[model samples]
Target: MIPRLKAWWRMFDTFTQRCLAVSVVLAIVASACLVQLVNVQLLDGRTTAEAATNSRTSKVTLSAKRGRILDTNGTVLAQSVERYNIIGVPDAATSFTPVTCGSKQAKSLGYCHAIDDKPVGATGAAAVARLLAPLLGMDAMELGAKLNGTNQYVVLKKEVTPQVKREIDKLNLGGIVYGELSSERVYAENTLIGALLGGVDDEGKGASGLESSLDDELAGTDGYTVYQRGNGGEVIPGTVTKTQEATDGKDVSLTIDADVDWYVKKVLSEGVSAQHAQWGVAVVQDVQTGEIIALEDSDSIQAGSDEAKLGSSRAVSQTFEPGSVGKIPALAAIMQSGVKITDQFTIPYEMEKDGQKFHDASSHGAEHWTLAGILQNSSNVGMITAAANVTNQQRYDMLCKFGIGQSTGLNLPGESNGVLTSPESWDTRSKETVLFGQGYTVNALQLTRAVSVIATGGINRQQSLIKSVSTSNGKQTSKLNTSATRVIDENTANEIKNAMESVADRWNKVINVSGYRIAMKTGTAEVAGDSGALTSIVADTVGFLPADNPRFVVTVVMKDPAGVHGGTTAGKVFAQIGEFLMQKYDVPNSAERTDAIPVEW
Candidate 1:
């Protein structure tokens, strides 16, 4: 009976141990399930499929429209427009068979015809190539080969018209997509201000000209977006979000008047066409404000382009030896040094120096002449004689003070400070030649503005493109000011004005309208070759209308053509533009003509 009891106890103990082992197993299984549930619901989600889509669902950035450029009167010069990019997702079309999609095919059906409903067999790359050729304007075979490339997302074309794009969208081509873009730096004037405004990059970023110079002001801040994405990089509509907003560029208003700019370009274009001249330029400035109203330039024709703003302001960038137009400033520099207008100087018939011949524009007498007569006749010898009274360094200094051989720092591209040899670099011939518009180079803008200083009460203010910028918050920040710089004295200023009037009255004889006193100067300079031989004369006529108290400083430089004379070509251009301004603006006539008698037809 005892043995039987022991056996039963053993059985019961074994049963209890077995039960505990089973319970431990069940507990382990339950813990794992709970942990997995927490991970999916709170800590993280499924990683392979859903997590991958989340990871790849990156936030894409968008660009805002760049600000428009307008003329002083609010005419559009440059602006930005909406553009787009067509993207493709090669995986979207399930019916597009792998063989037809430029990929190796599997014999089984599910893989190839799964994406799109399109048929699979005989219609391979060749047939699809032909269909894409005209639509894409691409070679069928080449495009097919590219479609075979590894990159699934690719750019098809750019600057596509919206009409064609709309038609394409209607076709409902599977796996194809579209994204936003911008066609920026669009010149409304279409090459009118091309060289001046310059071009932007594919991202609508500034590259040159005013666009580049003022890029900081004109360009807006770039923005970004950050959000959670699925494992496949696909955006999760419910979870993904955008953070910062993109800022658009600022609109800029120029000091330039579009009407005046149009006139300048039109007249210069006609001049270039008729004369068959290499190129030409006309610059207009406000004498009192130092504002560049118009700058028209031209270059070699591009066979088919019909743009006005060409040549890139050979006016501001070019620096050739200005033949005679330089005479006014040179002579003015001397007279201001106390050389009296009444002081007389006897000049030589032909001054022989350093194995070089120095002849006047014409043969003149070796007679005694006053300062006024010397300038009226534009006597080379007389100028040399007068310049002799001033030291070499003195003349150079005066030129420096006048802003020659120095950068104007104007807000423009391709500006040349020009060449000015110091006294140490000056040769005897150079010294003599410089006396009559040789041995040095000066740009059109600088020359005109130098005269402008004399016209605008001795203040040489810096030049600018942007007049003022009005912030989105309504505050206006002026770019340049009346007190930018002061370069000359008022007395010397008046004397120069007097001297300019003397030249116009005596030689150029500009049209003297009633109640208006005109001050003017005529300059005819011959361009020189590498051998220092005369190439062709560049005629330049620069004058200000209502000269007694100057208003418009018009300088015209007509490049090489047959009848090369500055007074004729540039003078005529000035007359037409001046007449247009006077009539269009209705600028009142000068107070009773105190300077000279009117020109009778």
Candidate 2:
């Protein structure tokens, strides 16, 4: 085979051999080119194309519409409105030119660069500013200065209404001046529910109050759009390659009544001012549903204001000793232990028990008083004597059952679970003070709900502020996952109710609401003042209306008031709010009180 190959090679000339080698080399080069062509066209074509397109693509975030906050009666408390930010490309504005009239007839028609038919006689940034100044309510010279910058992008103005945006659009300053979509939150009742409604941050996220707590429900999923852009960073027409629609936030309806809240805030502010107090809080709740109809604070700041960002709702944040108002639970515990409201006690001005001295708010000689009288007079000494039958653990358990020393379940931001220590942690003095509401602390909402247990016939319903949430799919009622539990028997609740009614009857002059009966308890406690001394007073009143059949519970608290007594200061505010509630709800007149337990033996 080797000899035959050598003979065939000799048959060809040197030139033909060289030509054959060149042809073979050309064919090999062509084959390699073909392979590369196939690889590029079949294997990586899409990747190459995508890379080319991506270089010119732009993605824009689309803001989702934040949900509206509504009151129980469908009143819009807070809402997001369509707004626009006037964006100016300073580089583009420097070359901006307005359309000029080409003919005399065109100039007479006022279509040229003129305002009210007055010739602008300007170009570039000055002309652009003159066209937009009146529409934006800005000074022409100032606007011109903003447009004269060298930056590629500049925000001339933000949160302009849609009407103003349209007016600017009609000026035909297309590339020079454009609008970027945005939203502005507008509060209907400015400062009425300010603290409770909360406000959103600059980026439109909830910062506090209900806005922060329910942010997830209120802030829906934000979508985005991907599109091709021109060299100048402008989105090319019809070049939307990808898009995802924004999901608008769900509308949250609160149990609060806007009108009622406004009224309560007004009354509470006036009351706080009249008493020369530091601040005040008032809360109203529905007996059956446990809905907070109104929550007001004297120092309520406007929503979306700088001050609101720093503070929280005082009703759920501020904690103080409930004083005599804490006695009802002790009374309930004593009565539940088979002690009757008619049970008598020999009360003294002061008494010593377990090396601790206890006294009533006022000095009194030894007198025969029933258990009902002890509560009606708010006698701390009488409370100690009457509570002698109940154990410390029993008192602690009762207070816990009444929702003391715990969050009210409203889930408000900065809410405090007021300090309630265990029974074992209580000292001898604390044990006795706890009976009359001094050893522990509670927020206004906690104290309100505690009183509500009696009004609700011993059922401790979960307190809720958000009534429902409405979304794209449908409306969903907020389920707090907390069930109502019975704290006391119905008979015991009625007995406590009747005793509170007697207390209200005793202070009818200040607490009475005409045409309706009220069952109330007043409290006053000495807390640490600004100087850190026990000189400040927390005066509060908590009760339910139409004592015969309670419908609503109202609580009013005043801090460091001139009228150091709860019955006179906070109680007066309660009466005003109660009267307004009765009239607003059209509640029927209460029947005359037929059941009254005698107080004095």
Candidate 3:
């Protein structure tokens, strides 16, 4: 068998054996190629295709629209408007050519630059400058200089209106000119509530004021889109692979009334100027709801301006000794401790107690006066005498309950909590001074809320400026979860109201409002001046109108005024604002004070 096999192998010639060996090698190579082709085309096909598509695709950020800041009446205070930054490709502009007339694309172009029915003679950057100058309100020479740079991309103009951008697009300079979407924050009321509304940064984020505190609610979620782009850097049509819709921010509605705020500011500025005061602040709040209807400062700050970035609402930031106005809380504590409104005391111009001497604002002989008369005349000596009934701890507790040295719950930026030391920290003179509102300090809003307790039937409610927030779905009222606590009984509040009414009656000539009864108290404290000396005075008045049926509480504070007494300077300003409020709200005339409490024996 082996000999037969060897004989058969010799049957083929050398040339045929060599050709057959080459043919076998070629078949093995073909089989290897087929296996590789199957692996590449089937196993890794989807991944390879995706990688190729991703190379040409780009992701673009879609900015979410910022919400509007609205007043109580639905008036737009602050808003964001769509705008564009005109972009120029300087390198591309060098090859720009003017469009020809009678062309299909030219027919649709509303305004075209042409000479003798021919395209503009200028070419390159000059042509682009000439065509865009009129639309962009720029000088042709300057624009040409900017477009002649070697930079591939340059911002030609920033924050142009959408209408202007459309006109620029009509030029049909696709590669040379384009637009980048942007937004411009506009304040409709300008200086009205400017500092309170605050301003935003270059990235459109809130930088100060209520704008900063409520930034999260005002700045919605930003979306994005992934799409393929051509070599020219333009998005290819129908190539959007993925997109996420932007969620617009919710509109913030404030409890403030624009008209009331304007009037209060006008009155406050005039009063501050009249007295040659350093600065002034005023606040108006609803008695029942604790809504701040008006917050004003003497110096107006324009929103989005340099000044707005430097300061905020002084009504909540500036703190000073409340002076005699501070006496109300101490007196209330004394009254609640079984001291009758008609309780009699022999008051003098000055007196010594606990080794500390105290005096009234005026020098007078010893006279008999009741608790009501003591507050009406604002006698410091009489107050200290009455404060004897309540302990220092009781006095401090009342002041704390009145919101002294505590947060206003407004969440306003830069707000000061004011200074209120505990009874344990009080010295001999501090204890006596605390009785007449001299040792502790409070801001305008805090003082306003302190007085409002009487008007609210002895209940202390949390104050708020924000009314509600509106989204795409609908409007949702702001749930502040404000706490309300009973500071005194209704009877005690009425007694205090009657006493404050007597104080207003004594100042009838200074704070008179026709057909209206106002319960009021004035304050005067000596504070450190700019020179850091205790020479400056803070004169202020706080009260609620229609004293019998309280509605609104108004407070006015003047720093370093010519007239140091709160009753004369701040009192006059209060009258003007009170009169306007009556007419604005159409409030009913106050009933005659038939049950007036006797201020004297």
TM-score to native of every candidate shown: 0.79, 0.86, 0.87
What TM-score does candidate 1 get on C-alpha atoms? 0.79
Residue 7 local lDDT, model 3? 90
lDDT of 1 by residue, 1-601 (tens): 9999768657767779789779999999999999988887776755555766554555556566576677778787777776665454333322233333333553442233212445433333333344444655778666555444445466656665566567555433434334435453457543465567665666666666666666777777766676664433344577646677778777778878888887888887787677777778888887767777887676422211222123334556777666766666677668767886667777656776667677677776676667666666667777877877777777777677667777876747678888988988888788777766777778888778766777776767676657776554556677655654555567666666666666666644443344455566666777775577787667677777776567788877777755676656666676677777667667778665354322211
Tell me the RMSD of model 1 versus the true structure. 7.4
Model 3 deviation from the true structure expressed as Cα RMSD, one decimal place: 6.5
The TM-score measured for candidate 3 stands at 0.87
Q: How far is each candidate from the true structure, as Cα RMSD in Å?
A: 7.4, 7.7, 6.5
Ranking of all predicted structures according to lDDT, beginning with the best and ending with the worst: 2, 3, 1
lDDT of 2 at 167: 88
Score candidate 1 by lDDT. 0.65
* Residue range 1-601, candidate 2, lDDT tens digits: 9999889878899998899889999999999999999998999899988998987786777889999998999999889999999988788788866666565755675555667767667888998899899999999999999999777678899999999999887776766788888899888755877877778998899998888998998998888999997754678999998899999999998999999999999999999999999999999999988999998899868887777766788877899999999998988988987888898888998999998888889888997889888888888998888787788889999999999987777788878999999999989899999888898999988999999999989888889888888886776777433579999999888888998999998899878899999999999999999899998999999999988879999999999999999999999999999999999999999998777988898
Candidate 3 per-residue lDDT over residues 1-601, each given as its tens digit: 9999779768889998788789999999999999988987999888888998886687867888899888889889889999998999898888776666767666786445564456777988998898889889999989999999678679899889999999888677776788878789999664787888888887889898878888999999889999987755688999998899888888999998999998998989899999999999999998989999999888778888767777787876889998999888888899988999888889999999888888999888887888989998899999888888688899999999888898988889879999999899999999888877788889989999999999998999899899999897886867443678899888888988999999999999999889999999998999998799998999999999999899999999999889889989999999999999999999999998998887877
Candidate closer to the true structure by TM-score (higher is better), 1 or 3: 3
